[model samples]
Target: MKRRATALATLLLTGAGLGMLTVPAEAAPAAPTRTTAVCPTGWGSTQKTGTSAATASLVNIRTGRHDCFDRMVFHVPGVGSSKIGYRVGYVSRLYQDGSGNHIPVAGGAVLEVRVAAPGYDPDTGKATYAGKVNKPLPGVNLTGYRTFKDTRFAGSFEGDTQIGIGVRARLPFRVLQLPDRLVVDVAHTWGTAR
Candidate 1:
């Protein structure tokens, strides 16, 4: 029994001497090897514009969330194969069209979205969106939105419509033109959109 005890002690001392049985005083946290490069960074905050002669009327506005960005969709009813044009850019301040009245948008940065379409029926002259100016968009519940702070109807005048988007900051954004809708996506963060 004494011999076995001695052998065990020798083994332990050897292992310790060889630096193979050492324990750290405090365990260090393992570093994460994962990356968030999946988020896109090409979309800039500069003014993005598309040119088209399509004449549509803005009918609705919608919002959705993604892993990397928050999106806003504008519904414009146009004729067959008609393309919508728009000018999306970050502005120092948003203003109401025709009246030049200052519009208050809640966020670190504001976006002035000018769509080449009116927000009312040209024939009937009836308002289609029906959303009031300087108020949160109707039916758009931004309860848990990460980037979106507020949205308001700037105004529609002279066959042109304007909308204001309030984001967390002046981050990268992209614009998309579809057959009858326009899309705008704002990234949540600079590097990792999560």
Candidate 2:
């Protein structure tokens, strides 16, 4: 009986040792690797001119956010395939549409956008955009944006319309004229300048 008990103890010790030496069938997965791409620099001085007059009228304005930049879009109807010319740049101040009064904007820098389109309906002689045509226009929300601070309708006169954009700083920007819209994208930084 004593010998049998000693043998049983030896067998239990061997089993425990073998269990410790055994390897797991599967190992935990490695932590995921993260990577981010570098964005381009030197986005500056964008301009485009259309061959024909703009047939559409400016009706609305909107803004959007991107990983590298913030965008503002000028909504126009009936633009279709026609060309629309524009000039956009940083300016000293923004002026009101018809009164020519200096309008105050909230930002470290200002951008002046001039579009070769009308903000009024030619047939009815009414403002195409239902929003306020002056400073403090309604529905231009600039929340949680990195570059844009504020935007205002500067004026619309003689088949041309203007807008003022307030930015965090004098950053790089580009302009795009789409089939029915004009888009302005302001970079978050000037390459390594940020």
Candidate 3:
């Protein structure tokens, strides 16, 4: 009887009225909060270039928006990994490769993305990436992108394909060469650089 009473007393003492029942700090539920996306460091805004020959044709273009960056990809279907090369740099204006025509793009800054490959099949003499040159890339809707404002196919000539990317501002970016894929990522802001 005494043990039962002592147990009852202990339970009551740890109840709501006594304010003794508690959860460990680490076990407590986290309060809801907003946070910015984290990003890697060390990427810069300087011009980046690599040497490559037209071993394969550029076949497609793709783009995506992430919390920290915006990505653009060039697809060269027949090329091996790291076979694709690029020259990415900020330019005052974007110009066509063959015609030298000035192509106006939206945004505060323009990045000239050059892939060292043709956008046409050499043997068949057929266009691989059928999108019109010097036109805003068809079907690319940058309506809600944090950094990208516009994208255009500058031109493709002499074993090179040029893309013009209009970004909100001059921001850091990085390039990745994968099998048949040349990926470029532009940070949403300076804080998200690299």
lDDT of 2 by residue, 1-194 (tens): 99999999999999999988887767646679765546568677444344436666888888899878899888886887567777788878888666878878779988888887778887888888755554644576788999998887777777778888889998888877787888889989877433
Query: In model 2, what is the error at residue 61, expressed in angstroms?
Result: 0.8
Candidate 3: stretches off by over 4 Å: 1-30, 192-194
lDDT of 1: 0.86
**Which ranges in model 1 have alpha carbons more than 4 Å from their true place?**
1-37
Over 1-194, each residue of candidate 3 has an lDDT whose tens digit, in order, gives 99999999988877855564567799899999787667976789999998784378888888898878999888898777656778999999998887889999889999999998888887887988877876888667887888899988976788888989999999999998888889999998787532
lDDT measured at residue 39 in model 1 versus the true structure, 0 to 100: 87
Model 2 residue pairs with clashes: 97-154, 97-155
> Could you tell me the lDDT of residue 87 within candidate 2?
74
Q: How far is candidate 1 from the true structure (C-alpha RMSD, Å)?
A: 4.4
- Which RMSD values do the candidates have, in order? 4.4, 5.4, 6.2
lDDT of each: 0.86, 0.78, 0.85
Query: What are the TM-scores, per candidate, against the unseen true structure?
Result: 0.80, 0.75, 0.80
Sort order, TM-score high to low: 3, 1, 2
TM-score of the candidate numbered 2?
0.75
